[model samples]
Target: MTITPLSDATWLAVAGPGRPASTTIGGWTLVGEVFNRHDPAVRQIPDDDPASYEKKMLARFWGRFIGVRLDGKGRLAALLRDPSGALDCLWWAQGPVTLVASQVPEWLARSAGAGWRINPARVEAALHDPYSTSGDLLIDGPAAVLPGAMVTLNDGIVSELWRPDWLARSAPALSDDEAAERLRDALDQVVAGVLKSGGVLAAEVSGGLDSSIVAATLARTEPDRVRLWLNAWGPDATADERPWVDLLAAHIGITATCQPRATGRLTLEMLTHLTLGIRPGLAAMDALHDADWARRFVAAGIDTVITGKGGDSMFIQPADAGVFVDFHRQRGWRAFLSRANIDLARWNERSVWTLIGAARRPRYTPAAIDDPNPLLRPRIHPEIARHPWLQGIDDLGPAKRRQILGLVQGCGLHGASFQTEVATVFHPLLAQPVTEVCLALPTPQLTLGRRDRALARRAFSDRLPDAITTRRSKGEMTAFYGHLIADGLDVLRPWLLDGRLAAMGLIDRDRGDVALTRESLAWRGGYVDIMTTAAIESWVRAWERRLPGG
Candidate 1:
């Protein structure tokens, strides 16, 4: 059985390549792969012997705890219950076995030991073992221990495989300083690895802490071979990335060209939407359009793009909400209920939605948490929660850390970014050495909230200029000339107003108006979102406008 939850959900349960994993177990449409979940019920077993009033009690318990049911043929379907016998979690329904997934100490009381296979490779093709189909990104979970290997999946496609060895933690782990040095060395190895395999020793330096570290390490190793490029809306007159790019260039003392070009919201007139179904209207479209920016590096003897894609998500922790939660937990419930200097309630009301709402004209409503929210636990998705490592996301306190783990773990919408420019994009920070140890280690060693990426700053203290290393605040490289939104609005006027964006089946037409307005007013949205849309539209139109069978 294929174990991985297919990235393209429609392909699995919908059409592509799989058997319908369903039947009327009790009367309800026992959706085999129910609602983006990939688990199955094997069977159900009973617990107690017949006592005096056992039938009535068992019937009520089964109905409530397990959601038990009967088909016209009297086939049974019910949820699994905990030891005290409560409807705690889903059941792996098989004959005579009542398997339960409880958050407490014990689980799987009487059922056949539920088998879980988690495939962790971001893409299954990378796993190299065609026999293993779990499709999870990390083998099982971050803490899941597995052996690295070279396995042949199919003829002609040999892939490298590495699994986490959590047991290694039993031995002495590298000290914070040692860990930093080891990480730098590992990064250096990756740079050589990429180049050795006829790939590129390149990085997309966003001047943020993440990419800056990569860029600095790479430059120190091979400054002469290094080529740097930045996405600029216009020339230096607009201050388009000239300041930071110039700083980096001078630091490396290399002829780093910022390659300032004008691939605004509507880059090419005829071409509109981009590949991977992104609208040239969003920030991803900008990257998709700028992906051609990669052609220059390709010409400059570079073949791959090493990037800090998951760096921010994996490396940094969000502002502390734990202060409030902890303060409440220790001091009193009243203190916790009150908003600390920082709280989720305030943030949701302040930053993202507030600004966007003002310009766009809609009020924001927050999602209400009903049951013991997934924010409190990982078992919300029974199948996904199987790997003990995902439990880390749960154990993490405060909502910010939880969100960060979610972003790092669940890359469900990565393709929406519309990054087709570079051949290969590597998030080396997600490299096993980096994720398992470097990130999960002591936070004070790396960063102290808004203090700084202390670990990176200290390691490269001598190499990087103080301007770069000491930088606490981050910026959007395109923020300088993002004012071009008004200009792009003029250019894309026909496409947006005429409902062409919708007709193309790319963007949600309902949202097209608001998105167009955001672009028209030069009201800065988000760098990621705006660029995504711009890139998608340009690619789609370029392909469509390609000389017919040229």
Candidate 2:
């Protein structure tokens, strides 16, 4: 489980540490690299002077990489997800990434040999018994370990490994206007950062609550500076998002470029984009035009891009959460209910529901599901119950399920958004602030009974049209690209049918194809995973072609 994070532009590849406890499984070794950017205990060797001088000597024949930035989030560094903690994935994936994994396993693992000791029962027990128990126990190794056993117990790493960045710390207090100002300022910072880096800020205005608000708010700034990008597919390809971007740009009075899906130029680069985006789950399959457009934007003087990625997750109320809360309270009793736990209370009906729903499984950390190890990640929901890797495993439980879902969408984006900006910074609702508010809010406040996603609509009501703000059904960006599937599938079929897909080596492509045919584009089953896989496969081919030996 070697993790090598790549900075192509800087030409740096930082190979991180590995898990001290995990044993080998098949050809791949397991590593544990807990990347808790907020964890206070974790420390790095101070760099009064740096290392990596010798490794680059051999790399000199190829190229050069700058010094590694391990302490901060200044640049995009892939967090290693392997249980063993090594930087070998990059060598296999054929890229440069930091394998910043741990070198020690607090608990003992099953003995080596004996047909992979960690069984489905162990996987289930780990996921179910969420609460940590501290005493140690003798862990029976593989059948071979019937005699000798490794000491095992609830170790801190399990809890520490999955901890979300949200619970870390807090920002200084601010007034309502100040909070709004903070968001706006973050937007400007992203814009300026991009501009300074000779990059353009690609504002992904999905017409949904988050991006729409971001686009509208950004419009109030220097509209000309922000380039609007939309994934044009589904019911209305040419017509989709035309009016919103059109009206917003017109009203804001700036230069807004709408980069839609193009007929030609679909290839493997999208895979690179997916990896860069850190969202290989969906974008890796289709609608690569969005990422292609992003790369184009970068080439066109847009080094920094700003997106409203975590906005919806932040305001989980007024949607499903609101609905959940409404169920418990009658017409009048709603106002009287106070949280059984926390003292802080906010009267905003919308905000309450939004936060609660998004934080349904508060204890379940999204980080666990958002593993960087490709074999263990970019999971598909429909296939989760059926994945070969999941053989003999039981349900992950409701709380854990919620956390896993949140991470797939939330944490996955945390990494994937990088594809847009060579150096991307999510503004307005970064994960830190957003996840806090979301988790604090109770279930009742999150899902407003009648007014689903109301908080978002109300925020942007003045700016967006009723068509988008109040829309119920989400469209398919991939279905719109159905025009190409028939033809593209002709190109995609051979690859899909290839041994790489059939062998379930790169991914469980066989199951993925089955799900792709049945599921919608949004759900991991639907469009998201399909488009992602398509893009990644193509990219892998191209990446291979671009490799030095090739």
TM-score for each predicted model, relative to the true structure? 0.48, 0.49
- TM-score of candidate 1 to 2 decimals: 0.48
lDDT, residue 433, model 2: 27
Candidate-wise lDDT, in order: 0.38, 0.36
User: What clash count does candidate 2 reach?
Assistant: 87
Q: Which ten residues in a row have the lowest lDDT in candidate 1?
A: 36-45
Question: Residue 321's C-alpha lDDT in candidate 2?
Answer: 35
Model 1, position 436: C-alpha lDDT score = 41
Task: Give per-residue CA lDDT, model 2, range 351-377, as digits (tens).
Answer: 554434433533322233322222222
Off by over 4 Å in 1: 1-175, 199-206, 224-253, 264-273, 276-284, 287-292, 317-392, 398-422, 442-445, 478-482, 490-515, 518-550
Best by lDDT: 1
lDDT of 1: 0.38
For every candidate, C-alpha RMSD to the true structure in Å: 18.0, 14.1
**In candidate 1, how many Å is residue 401 off?**
4.1
Tens digits of lDDT, candidate 1, 130-186: 112122222121111111211111121212121222211222445757866755665
Error of 1 at 463 (Å): 2.6
